[model samples]
Target: MTSYVPEYLKAKNRKTVFDLFLRDPELSRAEIVQRTRMSFPTASKAVDFLISRGIVTEIGSEEPVGRPGRRRRSLRFNPSAYAALALNFEGRVLEVGLVDLAGQLLQYEQHAFDCFHQTENYAQLAPMLQAVVEKSPCHVLGVGIGMPADIDNNAETVALYYDRQEVVVPLKDLFGDLLQALQLQAFYGNDVNLACLGEASLRGGAGEKMNLCYLTLGTGFGAGIMNNGAIWLGGHGRAGEIGNTHLGAFDLKGPLQTQIEPLETRINLQALEKAFGINLLDDTVLPQDTQDQMVEFLLPALVTAVYNFSFLFDMDQFVMSGAIPNRLPGLAACTEREVNRLLAYRKRSVTISRPVSAHCTLIGAANAVFEGTILSELQG
Candidate 1:
């Protein structure tokens, strides 16, 4: 029983046509109709609308088929027609990026927030956004912020975010000026959730009907969930907060001293450092086979997370990201294998993949504003 949504609500066909241009360098009208399974005229109408908005442009024509018949014009997604101001907030670092429609980061600037040298993050933020917006070559769509915090999607605000020193940062209140000063809208998303969105855009699959989860294993264990090309923030916006789940049973020669701790507190970099009695992720120290030891250590937490996400969200695709997991290539395969063993009775398929680019969070922030503003306008 698949519930149907109105075309105007989702703009299913229009977005499908537009997404093809982003994935492919150029496309023909006939090709769009063929790939999207839309009627010829329907494809043409969407293309015409995009062209009228300067979002899509007719560059030239394709090679004539057979006997040099009438050449069909080639259409391309015009990235310069609009751009988004993307901001990614880590504990101490703030990454400000100017991203075009094709997810290209045209310009990027990094700023330290709330540090001793930069105690005034709010003061530096407005200027940073203004500087990025001033240098854009096209119309600025809006601002997108990706932070490690709970985002209230309905209210369009970051509910809670803390700095490295555990100082509270009211993300929504801080952005009031940057957006208003620049006369732009703002979209807030969880950092990992935005990463998933960035990956989905890069994959450029069939429009809508997309379900994905991105597992992060850097300083902490977390996940980003995506459904229908949007971050599935769930009620109250804590959809993928897997860190606080208590440890589940698994085989390990030596477990952490505080085994009763939450899964995230147990598997994070700090936890591993304390568990292994050294900096497990020290700079320039790529452990030899000891990396395998690290994987074996976190295997229980990783397996449990995948199983929970697969069963709760019922998604078959999971992507593993962050410094530690990405460094260990076998981590994903091992986790997928264990999770499948758990789901063998159900006969369900689950796969764990790795990241294609390191800049997913930045690109995903840009994509948020693009979908909410530009795509909506195009649909209308």
Candidate 2:
């Protein structure tokens, strides 16, 4: 059975319409009505609302055919209407970008912080956001943030978070303040999930109704699960903290290690250095294939991790993406091989998938802003 779009999503169709205008700025009402398959009254109401919000405008007009020529106006998204801020805090720096409703990047900034511990991240971030907000165009909507953390909107904490040094930060608190201070709404999401959201929007995955799990491998590992086009934020808004699961346990030195070894301990950058018996960061003698070997070991483990998660969660398929652009294809291939290997053991088959295009959590962070900004305009 084909599930109908939910009422909330139907109400949010203004976003879908505006997104179309952003794509093709000269679409006629008849074209939009045909594309959206919406009743004329519904389409007119939504389009008029967008026009009133200054998000859409009548670009020009087309003459009606035959007897009495009537000018029918064509609609276009006003490129100058509003803007959004997108930031991704992963790896080397805190990346910031200014994007318009049409997804055009206006400005971008990055501040590299050698130390990203929880104690000082907000101290570092608040000013950066202030600077971006001040420097950005006045029409900017709000900010959207992507972080390597498990965000609990209700509790306002980072349940499981990572920084450059595998440190923790109060993501929700810092985000809440930046949002309030800048007087902008914000969303704090796991980086992997944001990448998934972005891929679902800009990439070929758009308009498809399917369950998706976005797996990210970089300095850290995480997954974003979307079921039937809706984010399944668990009770604590940490549904996809798959990196915390243990692939295998070994007795290491300490109380926390004794508790249980996390998969992060087995596959993160720190683990790769330990596994290779060399310093990948500082050592120049590291072979060219050093990164490849790390992927060979970790990709299989990650594949099993996904298999485990899928079995438990009943997800149909997944995609792998993140900062490691050069490595995604290999990771996808390895994951496919590993999944096939597992199928032999289970005596059953399952589907595995990849994103339609190269992905950046930064891009998705931008989309989060666009989606939210549209929703806000609709409400107001």
Summed backbone clashes in each candidate are: 0, 0
TM-scores for all candidates: the values are: 0.85, 0.75
Stretches > 4 Å off in candidate 1: 1-10, 62-71, 115-121, 161-172, 247-260, 326-329, 341-347, 378-380
| Model 2: residue 126 alpha-carbon error in angstroms | 5.3
Q: How many angstroms is residue 33 displaced in model 1 relative to the true structure, after the best TM-score fit?
A: 1.2
Which of the numbered candidates is closest to the native, going by highest TM-score?
1
Worst 10 residues of 2 by lDDT: 160-169
In candidate 2, position 142 carries an lDDT of 70
| CA RMSD of all predictions | 4.8, 5.5
**lDDT, residue 87, candidate 1:** 85
Model 1, residue pairs in steric clash: none
Please report how far candidate 1 places residue 178 from its true position, in Å: 2.9
Candidate 2 yields a Cα-based lDDT of 0.67
Name the top lDDT candidate.
1
